[model samples]
Target: MQITPVTPDLAAKSLPVIADAFANAAHSDGHEADLVTALRHSSDYRPEYDAVAVNDEEAVLGHAMLSKAAVVADDGQRWPVYVLAPVAVTPAEQKKGLGTALVMYLETMAYGDGIRALSVLGDPAYYGRFGFVPARPFGITAPYEVADENFMVRELQEGGLTGVHGVLHYDPAFGLTPQA
Candidate 1:
């Protein structure tokens, strides 16, 4: 499988792949596809961070996106961060590493873009293999109540999360009303 950036024309095609992949997931909240749609139109959206894993036939087998986010320190300081969400792979494509490949590829792009860290709400067992660890220890917290283990973060560089501590804030598209 080949991992490639999802260009504008390919964005629509990725929707179904994402929907289908999350449709039957035991832990899915059922709005992952919709979240992707909202994020696409949000001001923080970055097309380069949207990607897909394609098979020999060029069919989208998996998808992932990293978008703009922030961590607000108690002193009201804001530090930019990246949030990975809605990563999906068709059920048939699971266990073949397509999802992992897509995520790793996106990480390289984000790292190149100078992003300090990446965060995701996912199974620790699955994401840990990629070096993701609980964000709390790094002084980061999710906007909503989440299992500490499921909210993971990876520092793209040494000291990436250093001095960056606070409640995490995601894009408005995440369906959370921004605190005034």
Candidate 2:
């Protein structure tokens, strides 16, 4: 399988692939596909950070996105961060490392762009393999109540979160109100 940024053609094909992937997921909220649509229209959207995994035939089989975000400290300080959400892989395409390939690709892209940190609300068991750890210990908290284990963070570079800490503020496109 090949991994590449979501071009217009890939985007067109990946939307349904993404929607259907989530629709078949037992853990989805059924709104992840819609969230992707809204996020694309938001100011924080980064087209280059939206990526897909394709087959030899160039059929998109999975999708992943990283959007701009921040963490606000009690002193009103805001630190830039990236939020990884709604990674989707067609059921038939899962378990073959397609999702991991997409995520790892995003990680390389984010680091190349000098992004210091990434946060995600996902299964710790799955993300842990990528070095994700509970964000709470790093002084980061999710906007909504979430299991500490599921709300995770990873530093792209050394000391990326050495002193970073605060309530996470996801892009408004996520339909989540930022908490001060």
Candidate 3:
């Protein structure tokens, strides 16, 4: 599988396919489509964060994105961060490591571009292999009540998230319940 940055035109077409993959992956989890839609329309959606993996024939088989994210420090400062969301591999392509390849490729791209920290809502089992740990380790929390393990962060630069503290504010597209 070959991974490449998504071009503007390709981003438009691949989004629906990515959404469908999210829907399928989240079928039993509920709120899959909502998450997918939020990521699609989030203000942070940029071509730089969008990527697709294609086979030798150029058929898209996997997709993923990274977006602007922030955490409010205890001192009332906002620290810039990045969020990875809606990573999906075609159902037929699942278990062949395509998803992992896409993620590694995107993270490498982000690192090369100087993005230092990233967070995501995903299974710890898989993400841990990529060096993602609970955001709490960096004084970060998700807006919603999530299993601490499911909300993870990774630092591309050593100590990237160190000393950063605040509730993680994902781009508005995440559709999280408002805090009462």
lDDT top scorer = 2
Runs in model 2 deviating more than 4 A are none
Query: Compared with the true structure, what per-residue lDDT tens digits does model 1 show for residues 1-180?
Result: 688888776688888889899888898888888999999999878888989887788788889999889888888999888998978998887888888888899999998988899999999999999999999998898878889999999999899999999988889888774421
Q: What TM-score would every model get versus the actual structure?
A: 0.95, 0.95, 0.86
- Score candidate 3 by TM-score against the native: 0.86
Candidate 2 lDDT by residue in tens digits, 94-172: 8988889899999999999999899999899999999999999998999898999999999999999989989999888
Ranking by TM-score: 2, 1, 3
lDDT of 3 at 96: 88
Whole-model lDDT, model 1: 0.87
In candidate 3, where is summed lDDT lowest over 10 consecutive residues? 24-33
For model 2 the local lDDT of residue 129 reads: 97
- The backbone clash count of each candidate, in order, is 0, 0, 1
Best by TM-score: 2
CA-lDDT, candidates in order: 0.87, 0.89, 0.77
Higher-scoring candidate on lDDT, 2 or 3: 2
Q: Give lDDT for model 3.
A: 0.77
The candidate 2 region of ten consecutive residues with least summed lDDT is: 171-180
